[model samples]
Target: MNLLNQTNEKIIPSLFLLLLITGLFSCTSESELTQVDVVVYGGTSSAVIAAVELAQSGKSVVIVSPDIHIGGLSSNGLGFSDTGNKEAIGGLAREFYHRVWQHYNDSLAWNWEQHSDFGNRGQGTVAMDGESRTMWIFEPHVAEQVFEDLIAENKIPVFRDEWLDRETGVEKENGRIVAIETLSGKRYRAKVFIDATYEGDLMAAAGVSYHVGREACDEYGEKWNGVQAGVFHHTHHFQVPIDPYVIPGDPSSGLLPKIADEKPGANCSGDDKIQAYCFRLCMSNHPENRVPFTKPDNYDPNDFELLGRLFDSGWNEWFNKFDLIPNRKTDTNNHGPFSSDNIGMNYDYPEASYERRQEIIQEHANYQKGLLYYVANDERVPEKIREEMKNWGLAKDEFTDNGNWPHQLYIREARRMIGEYVTTEKDILGERLVPEPIGMGSYTMDSHNVQRFVTEEGYVQNEGDLGVHPHAPYQIAYGSIIPKKEECKNLLVPVCVSSSHIAYGSIRMEPVFMILGQSAAVAATIAIDDKSAVQDISYLEMREHLMQKKQVLSLND
Candidate 1:
């Protein structure tokens, strides 16, 4: 169970030997070295889009990814895209959707269900738009294939399953990153680097300043920034008075599982707590394609005791978020109280070591699996609910390598880089015009429940669920993607941009990530041509390039 110790004892030694050998043979062997114009460090949607942009621009780029699979949450199970203003999404992001549209137009893509039978329902828009030639929703496998096709067509080299050596991996000279070495001892030399990871691991390892948790409203001069103790924008909170104790009315008994044994923090104050994380499951209702929810190893029924209590409290809205995708499958997300989001369990994940992070990931996987099994099989679950739950299982075709479970965890929020410009709620609300626009974000500012804590009334309640819509689609500034010149001159972070916690809630959409990724690549090219730092790149020139690439930088465009 001590994953860190095991990694240190076994993996570290072998990695060290590999590093030593690679260092000794550094001058002679070309296999250990790769030189590219840009090294995008991640396999997320943004990483793929950035690499493709660089390739299309005739620049050599490579993706050094920690994931075995490509496309992050987009290919995982987030097929129910959270697109705000679809028109605001253009460039490579829209191209990705257009490719998805092209795929579904073929009859072979609709194997489980007929294309005509599948209704055109999406998140506040049509699933498929014939006029725009874009499909906003799709299956996990289809999204993955689209990313793979883009990589293949662009001829971008990708090194899969290569983890960054966070401690001594990056070599910087005169505030510029010279090269970066992975744990496998392969060194990549690049003029510009893009960190497209959800966790911002490379950005953190490169000594860039970042924030892990929510900031106080005062810090950013904004509402909905910090620990929202009383705000409940979503229905994920306890509606009725639920006892916190294990035994119904006994004061001697301890608190129920998953309920924090502390007071909900002061409202509008800063806290080092992160929003919950969960796996956006891709499930199927089709009998032929369904893989019944199986009982996971070490399954304990007591873990879901609170959920059973909730069921007893007359809450039967568990099926509210089974958003349907193509091929009779669903992009299942965390919905009701005591659902998939493991509240207050991922606070350390943003800064944890790789081994420690794996432990956390495994723990979350077990918790979710146990919850599913409990709801589907346990006698404590209502008979009506159990019968319906039994019909839906994991899709057999999706994530074939990982037992039909999602390969990527829904990392809702993580280490956000405090780069040259920090995007606050003001920027998202259009109170202040963003300077040097690169991309636009129009999604509602949303955050899942952060903690399940006991109220003063001695009842269990969830906190930190927030949803606020912007006045209009807001432009993202170029400064948000680049690090401060003194921190790192040649690095860009598109996924984990420089933003406040609340502002990030709006910016952290897949399409926006792709748009920013393409814009980052354009900025990288500008920096390279001008022989200047990423901070010093000419915004006017970069804007010209972005427009030519068909990136939607403004509402007027």
Candidate 2:
């Protein structure tokens, strides 16, 4: 294997340099030595929780992340917290939110708005719990600070901006990862490994089996696994008929920009297309804290023509879900048919190269920024709607280094590991009891639109917007987090657990990730102690360990 630059040019070193680079293997050099009991990958909210749990379990650990900032969506403008059934959340996940509550208790934390003015509000839940003293909604910085405190308190080593050298970095011996290296030539040798990343990058590099896209309903016996067209139960579908063509009523003219010309697939067939990804914008209307929406440098009016048409069709519900956080900030997520989710454009992101991923991120940023500018200033927008939109802008104090923009994109679904068991709709709906419960996921099986295409009737429609409520909070199986017994015995996956697309939609919440992360760490420590594969660990012992950590394994009657 060779390390290639962006242009695919190889950089070869002299034999002496090669010897020096790999000297730790031959000469056991101390400088190149990095040994730990547990090595966690990704800087997500789950990653931090897992690292803390490992340290608390009396084990040495390190966090290897490609991001400059940690906490993933929790600190990336997802302050509204997409938590369902908070009672199901326990352990480190609840502690993180409690920390957020503690931060806001300080009078200095409320800068833009008075604490009284920002009354308790959350998505179908209580924002503040007096008895628990935990705040579920907060500004982005508060969440980041809480994560930083977790790291500082534990004294866990972290190496940020270290991309995994996927092709040749992971070294394995007899189907077990012995050591892994990063693109910066940093190596980590560990007894056990956990892939806590949303993308499952480390698991993939270690040759673990995983699935990328939706599985067919037939394949998993799931009701909502595959391409779902004509499933317009939400307001996210085009409310009124809108012509997708550039020149209305003329077939010769091309379709409007951003409106795909492809035909959406059969209703229940599997495809390689993933759900849309977007930067959850943190916005505010306060005069002191608001930075007015600025037109992106590559703004294109034609990109959002369909939105103008929606406005003309008497669809003015643009602010339906501008979920408010503390300090006058809003977690602005995709609300309607044409919103922040750059649908269909992120199909290539899950497996794209780092350079290509950056380009895709920039494109999403430009598109969302341009959409805000259009809604605020475009003449085609309804006067009343434009006026309301003009009042909201990016928060001035948040993401100060990135021009008040979110640093992380909401990767709703990605590469899911195909492990010992796959969590399907049956598991989520409580039709089938998952054995060896590790954690619980109660969020609705929510998936954003996957494709926006023209219908046979010549109207634009968005497919794959699904929101099905589960019968109750369901237990996540321990087998779902461990890879196949034959593939990789020492590795555990938390963020990208084995699940079908529809089930993962519910399990993909940040709180659920943290819960699974803590569970993963417990299992990892146990596996190291037993000197056995993660799949071979005793389920009873795992459940007992999780319960000792305050994890809720089974639902109460």
Candidate 3:
């Protein structure tokens, strides 16, 4: 390798060049070092909102994102936001929806469908409220544009395609992160740091305590913590007595692909398994901007044999949650039995290597695409259902870079920080009161199916599908976002806050993420001002700052 000499000339095989480089072999240059007041990792909606809040507070912040896009699922195909209580949503989260409302108010946004034709279908409130003028459901591109506008308006620096060096790149001093080096040879030094990634990569790299999977019910003294098998509140599981074997009545023929041969564990027991993941497909029926669903390259009909058996057994709820948005597009989520959710395929995603994670993502994509193709084209499907499925195709204008596919997958839950305070089912259901309110979450304790295994009586069943409801809007504590006092002094985790697996199910909504993002930024600024650890900052001061920014810290606020 060649290096620059003292005269700024290229030299090879010289001790002078080695000394100039400052190491035996180093890929990074001092010019790539960035100093900022705050360094926010991950490019989710929370990251964008936190960076904006930091910039508004006169702090230099940089967003280091692994993905190409900024907004995670909010700008990805989850246009149909899963907001439980609109009153619980305030601050930058509400501003985002308000901007979405303003976009649809203009006549030019109504290209595929007329403004009058796309009526209000949102829950909890009127869709087109001339009063609040906040539209919840919208196209994917509109949400991305809104997030982009937030970054542009605040002049926040965002570095995309920069993966953190998880192994040895984090430089720490006195229980605080001094700087972080990325895989692209870029280093960032900051006084404060916020980890907004759904996977909690930065927090884990900082040696923060975190849990990957479910906790036993006894561990948190909560009722809904682990291994829930027969609780079928949603219609996402198999509804029919379909055989899971490759052969109808022959056990020697072996179980079908993707179905585990082991028996499912007892209810409420802990395991390392995580919920399934799927792409929030943006499907449209508008012929002008619809790309007909095409079969993926690795299409295999036998891969979806279980779904065919479900259809043959009279379980036909193919369109349970095809939530429609503006511009005739749909936020097509995993609906009925054997829908878009690729079960038992993403168990190792939270801890997988970068290359392995990419493989898992591609596997989920192929599974979902094959499911759509099977519904639209397979001869074995019911004729009427197949015809209806044929009507919906991917929106052409959305996700233009990836052939009408979302850039990010829905990572429902990952490494949750076991910080100073842990939110549990009691906190979510209003049984346990939470102090130091920073934000609120009202969504149901919802987790997708985790494992597909054989039952005791020789039948296939899914476990870990939970849908319990919270009593009311509950406050998330300030201590939940900060790491444990002994682990890290300056880091804050908003997305993967300290919580039980079931509590995280409720706190994992996009709006709650943005709310906590704002709260985390305020807390970081307070810590920086006082020159104290994040855990040592005053909760009341942080709350006052959040309230000034119109953030609803508690239900009473």
Candidate 4:
């Protein structure tokens, strides 16, 4: 009777042993199985919003999150919001900001500084609006708390740290995903699945089509699609000529660290290179809340030789992008020719194995951490810059679980699903009309530097940094979120949407992801109710529901 305690029993019957093994296997499988109306994968801002929307719509939904902490980059130091057209953001996305505004309204929220001391600085509008009751900029912890509150208020069940079995987790029948199993053996069965991950892992595992890296200009009929070798946008590129070799003008000395040896590809041509990734560090100048930057274990002064040379050349713009957030904190992003963007080091991240991706992430973290340490302590740095850098450090109260470092990397670009409709610059620039509008995006087509390589003239330069403003806030089509019917009928992709690299540059904003997440949930709900494919959902009906939910589908709306 005590089968679990049996070890080399005197005369165990084979028949009894077989029955016991079968029963145990069945019980294990049953316990691991989770059935729901909709399963949202990922733990990003989009994932949280999608699950909340599904719950609000009376669907039995569950969030199978790969992240231990939700809200992705929003809570991971990107609190200086990149919202372009504030009016274009509505639905749960706007609600998230409203909650942020509410939290800051309390005097207790300002722990480090007075509310009036925090100036109203934002991308294009006031950071905090009294009439709209929305606050665009915030501290990282506050954003994370808002996301947690939303999930708790909606009673959404989130299984955190559940990594999907990317190779064979998705169980498909007749091109529809029946279930997805995580690496922990937890199985999620749902009528509809939404891939809210920035990496598009679920969509790819479900055999959905996707494209990585940049597309050629001709492929999508877009002007800013491919290798932008000579195009310099913003202030990320070198303003003056910087030598590529360790010895100035001596090619025999070899290229300096961080400078790619390969020649940058031709302009207007396609390449497999992706934009650089960095940690949007939440830094603080307040002495009580600042954790002074420390040199990384693997810090190599030689790695920053170019940066030292740039300093010698009078390129002192390190603090230009330390955008201010509340609580006397800053959302410090990459700036100048050599700041934090780890260029040419993440090309294999989008499709790499999980272990490999982690390695890449760690490598990036080390590079950034080392850069900060070098600036603060290295004698090569200018005294003015070094003294100023010493004042800022990682926020002591943020990302407590990760040694005050940001938990999420700014995955600027990744595997983009090539769904029914691929958004291109034509759509973003108002040259082409979007069909079946679901949301609107107005951010500039902004792509960070992809590669830092030696020019034909033998000088160091950065390529693929672009910033072209859209004609206006443009509508995003429903087809952009759903896979082709033949590929996967029951799955929707909100984060890694179908779009050309240039168009995704604008649509990739955090607020846009939240907007699409809500829209995707609504579409999935319609598909589940009608017992129809996500691709076949009626656009008119979806539009009506979106309007009711206060989603800004177009500029006219």
Estimate the TM-score of every prediction.
0.95, 0.94, 0.94, 0.95
Query: What lDDT score belongs to each candidate, Candidate 1 first?
Result: 0.90, 0.87, 0.86, 0.90
Weakest ten-residue segment in model 3 by summed lDDT: 1-10
Query: If the candidates were sorted by their TM-score against the true structure, best first, what order would they fall in?
Result: 1, 4, 2, 3
RMSD of each: 4.5, 5.0, 6.2, 6.8
lDDT of 4 by residue, 280-303 (tens): 999999999999999899999999
Error of 1 at 436 (Å): 0.5
Residues 1-557, candidate 2: write the lDDT tens digits.
01122121111335335534744123246435467888899999999999999989988788887777889999999999888988888889989988888888888988887888888878768898878888889888889989989987986767777788888989999989999988777788998999988889999999999998888899988789899999975788996799888888886898887777788778789999998999998999999889999988888898898898888888878998899898888998899999999999998877888778888888888999999999999999988888998999999999999899988989998899999999998999999878999999899999999999988888999999999999889999999999998899899999999999999999999999999999999999999999988888888898888888889876782
For candidate 4, what is the TM-score? 0.95
